[model samples]
Target: MASSDTYAAHAFHHSFDKERASGAITLTDVHVQFHNDQGQVRFPVSGTQFSLGGASDRLLFIRHPSEPDWNIYTSDLSILKHPALQNDVQIQRRVQQIKNKRRFTWGVFASVVMVLVAIPLLVVLFMDSLTGPLARHVPPEWEQKLGETAFAQYQMGQDFLKQEESDQLLDPLLQPLLQQLQDERYPFQFYISSDDAVNAFALPGGIVVINSGLILKADSADELLGVVAHEISHVTEQHSVRNIMGTAGVYLTINAMLGDMSGLLAMVANAAPYLINQSYSRGFETQADEKGLALLYRAQIEPEGLVTFFEKLREQEQKQLDKVAGEDNRESIESTLQFLSTHPATEDRIDHLQEQINELPHQNTLDLSLPFTTLQERVKRFVAKEDEEPET
Candidate 1:
C-alpha cells in the first residue's frame, strides 16, 4: 500500500540499520548513524564532539562524545576518505600524530632493552683483551699510591719487627739477589711481620712483606731467596696494579653502561682492601714462577731451592691430609693453610719448577746454611718473647 519513494527510503533505512549494528557508520544530513552493543543510534554532529582513539595503519578509529566506546572503520573505506573530513583538519592531524608517537615509543623501548642486554655480554666476552690495554693506562705514581695505601692498611694494629732486626736478618740475604736482578725502577723495601703464617706477599710498589713463620720454614738462604725473588717479580711485573685496574675497569664499565655513578666512590674507597685480600690468579702465579726462576738464574742462585721448598710444602700437606679421617676433613684442613691457599702449590706447578731446574747448569751457589740457621733461631726467640708479653 506504500508509494515507491516511501518504499525506497524504507529499504535504505533497513540496510543502514544492519551496517550500523556491525560498527559501521555513515554521515547523512550532518548526523552519524552507528550501532553499539545497545543497538542502532544516531547523533547530530553539531552537538557531538569527535576524538581519535587507538588506530593502526589499516584501520581508522573515531570516538564521539555520546558513545562510550570508539567506532572503528577501515582506513580505505570510502566513508573515511570522504571530503567532509577535510573540514575537521585538526582532528585528523591529531589522530595521525598520536599513531606515529605510539609506534615510535614502542620502537625506542625495545631498542633500549636490547642495548641493555648486549652491553654486559660484550664486556664479558672481550674482558681480557680490553683490560690488558686499560691497565697500561694507570700511571706508575698511581700504582705506588695504591700499594702504599694497602700496605698501611695491612700494618694497622700489627707488630712489625724492628727495621734494624729485619735488615740484620734479611739484608744479607736480599742484597745479593737485588744486585743480580738489577731492577732500580722501583724502591724495593722489604719488611718482616711477626705473624706466624708461612707467607710472603708483594705490594704494588715493590713493597714485600715476609712473615717470621716463612723465615723459620726456610732450610737455607737460597730457599728464602727463591721466595723473595718470586715476590720481587710480582712487584717488577706490576701484577698487583694490573690486577686492581683490570677489576676496577670492568666494574666501572658496567656501571657506566647502566648510567649509575652513585657507587663509584664506594668502589674506589674499597680498592685498597680489595687488593690486600685478593688472591693472584693462576695465570699470574705461573708468570711469577717463571720470572722468579729466570731471576734466580740471573742471580746465579740455585733454582733447585725453589723446587725443594715446594716439595717440602707438598709433603707437609700430605702429612696433614694423612692425619685427617674423612675426605671432608681433609678438604677442610687443606683450605685452612693460608700459604698453600694463596700460592696453590699444585703438582703441575711443582713439576714445572723441577723442569726449569733441570735445564739450568749446576753451580755452587752461596753457602747460606749457617746464616739461615741463625735467622730461624732468632725468629723463634722473637715469637717466644711476644708470647710472654701481655696484650696491651
Candidate 2:
C-alpha cells in the first residue's frame, strides 16, 4: 500500500540546441518535485524515472521546497547519467523479437500438423469413393425386382423378334458361352432380343441381354466371347453394387466437406434411377476388361477372339454408315456405332485385347468344337420350326 505522503517524481531531457535557436539557454539539473495533497513535507518515492529525446547539452534539477537538499536515488540518477538507454532498449527489443519468432514458429508448426492430418484424410476419402458403392445398401430383393422389370422388356423385345425368326437362332451360340462362364454361386440368366441394334447390356441381378444384331454382326465366336467376358465380369464382380456404394459414399463425403450432409440421403435417393442405369466409368471398364480377359485365358479360350471381334464390329459400323442417307440417319447410325456408344468401342477394345494377348505368356489356342456359322444356321432353323409350330 502507498502512503499518503508518497509521490512519484519524473524527469525528461530535451536538446538545448533547438532551444538555443529561439533564445539564450542555461545549463541546469532537471527533475520533478512532488508534494502531498496537504502541501506539507515530501516523502520517499521508490520508482522515479527519466526519459530523453535527441542531444542534451544542459542538465536540469528539482527538489521539494521543504527538502531542498534531499538526495536523489542512485538507481534513478544512474538512469539519467547516460545520453540514452541503449543497452536496456536492446534487451527490450530482443525480448519482443523472441516473442514474435515463437508465435511465428508455432503458427508454422500448427499449419504443418493440419496439412499432415488433412492429406491422409483426403486420400482415404478418395480411395473410399472407389469402393463405396459396393455396400449393398439397397435391398437385394429390390435390385432383383428391378431386374425382373427389365425381363418384361425382354419379353416385349422377343415378341418384336418373332417377325424376323432370328430370335431362336442366337440361343445355341449363347448357351455354350453361358455354360463356360456359369458359376454355381452366382447364377446368370441370358436373354436374346430381336433388337437389330448392336448392343449388349447387363442389369443388376445377373441378367444380360444381347441384341440379335450383335450375334449377326460378330465375326467369330472369340469376338462374341469378348463381349460375354466383359458382361460376365460386371456380374461376377457385383460391380453394380460396388458402383452404388462408391457413388453414395462420394456424395456423402462431398456433402460433409461442404458442411451439409443432412441432405445426402435424399440426394442419393433421388439419384437411384440414374445410378441404376449408369454404365461403368472408363477406369471401371478397363478393370473389368482386364479381369475378364484373365478369366477367358484361364478357361483356355483365346483372348485374341476379343480383339478380332472388335475389328469386325468396326467394319460393320463403317458399312452401316455408308448405307445411311440423311444427316439424321448419319447421326442415328453414328449413335449405333458400337465403339462410339458401347462400353469399350469394338476398335479401342480390340486394341486393348491385343495388348493383353501380347502380355499373357500362356497363349493357348481354344478349340471350340462347334463352328459358330453352322451352329448359328442350325439355331435359326430350329427357332423357325418352333415358331411355325404354334403359340401356347
Candidate 3:
C-alpha cells in the first residue's frame, strides 16, 4: 500500500497529448491534485472520471474534469492500493457503471454473432424445402409484377420477333401445350427473342423467352414445343420464382419468411437484370425436365421430342467445341451458341432424360407438321428489318 498521501503518476500535457511528464498525485474526498516539476493541477472528485479496467490489469484510468479528451493511464502499484480511491463512494460507483456497461456490450455482441450464424445455417439446411412451399404462398399478382420488372430489364439489349409474328410462330405450338396444363396458376405469355443463341428461359411470372436460334435448330414443332414445355414447367413447378427467391440475400430471406412481399420485390427488382441468366440447380432442372415430359404426355405430343431435342443440343455443342478444340477464341463460339438452353451443357443430361423416356410406354403422338421454312423466313425478314437504318 502507498504509505504517503501522494503517489507518482504520468499526466498528458493537454487533451491526452503525447507530451507527458512525471507527477505526484493526491486524492481527497471532494478533490484530486497533481504536482510536477512545472506546476500543480487539481480537480473535484465528483466530476472527474475514473476507470478500473479489471482486478487483473491493476491499473487506474482517468479522464480530466471538464477536459474529456485529456486522459490518464497509470499502472503504479501504490495508485492501485490508494485509500481515498478505494473508499470513495462516487468513484467506486462510476467504476462499477463502466464494468456493467462492458458486460452488457459483450452480451449484446455475442447475441448478434449467434443470430448471424444461426440464420444461414437454417437456410442451408431447409432452403430447398422452404422455397417450393414459400413460392406457393407468393401471390400470383406479385409474381406477375416481379416477372414484368425482370422481363423489362432483360429487353434492354435484346431484340425479339413482333407480337404478330411471335403469335404466328408460337401460338399453334403453345396453345396445345397450355391446354394440357391442369390447375395452372400463371397467365403464361411467350416471346421469341430474335437473337441466335440456342437458349430459352422463364421468369417469375409466366414470362418465357425463346431464342430464334433454338427454333432454327429444331427439326419439328415437337422439338420446339418440347423446349417450351420444359420452360413452362419451370414456371408451373415454381422453379423460376424459386430461382428469384434463391438470389435474395439472408436479410431478404428473413423478410420473405416474415411475409414482407414489398421488401422481397425490391430485392427482385435489383436482382432482375441477371435473373434471366441465373442457372437452375441440377435439382431444379431435373424437376423441370420430369414435369415437362408429363406436360408433353398430357398434350399427346411425343415425349420422345423432348429427349430428341436434348440430343440435338448435345450434338450441336460437341460439334462447336470440337471445331474450336485448340483455339483460344472458344469464347467466340460460346458468344453465339450459349447453350444455357439447358444446364450442364445439357452434358450427360441426355442420359437421364433418355432413361426416363425408355421407361415410359410409347404413345401414338401427334405430328405437328409445322412450317419450319416459313418460320425461319419470317425470322430472317424481321431481323433484317430491325437492322435497317431509318431513312433520312
Best by TM-score: 3
For 28-106, candidate 2 gives per-residue lDDT tens digits of 1222333322222233222222222122212223333345433222112232333222234543354345345546766
322, model 2: CA deviation in Å?
7.7
Worst window of 10 by summed lDDT in candidate 3: 383-392
Tens-digit lDDT track of model 3 for 224-294: 88888999998888776677777666677777788876765665556556666678876788888889988
Q: How far is candidate 1 from the true structure (C-alpha RMSD, Å)?
A: 11.6
Give a tens-digit lDDT track for model 1, residues 1-392.
21111000011123344533344465653565654444555665444443333442434444566754435343433444444444465645654575566577668888898988787778766654444444444556666777889998988876677767767877767776788765576778888788877778998767898888888888777788888888898887767755654465556856644655344333444577777777776667887888999888877777877877777778877887887746767766766654456555566688998888888888767766776787788778777774344121
| Best model number under lDDT | 3
Clashing pairs in 3: none
lDDT of 1 at 186: 77
lDDT per prediction? Answer: 0.66, 0.53, 0.73
TM-score, structure 1 vs. true: 0.59
In order of lDDT, best first, we have 3, 1, 2
Better of 2 and 3 by lDDT: 3
Show the lowest summed lDDT stretch of 10 residues, model 1: 2-11
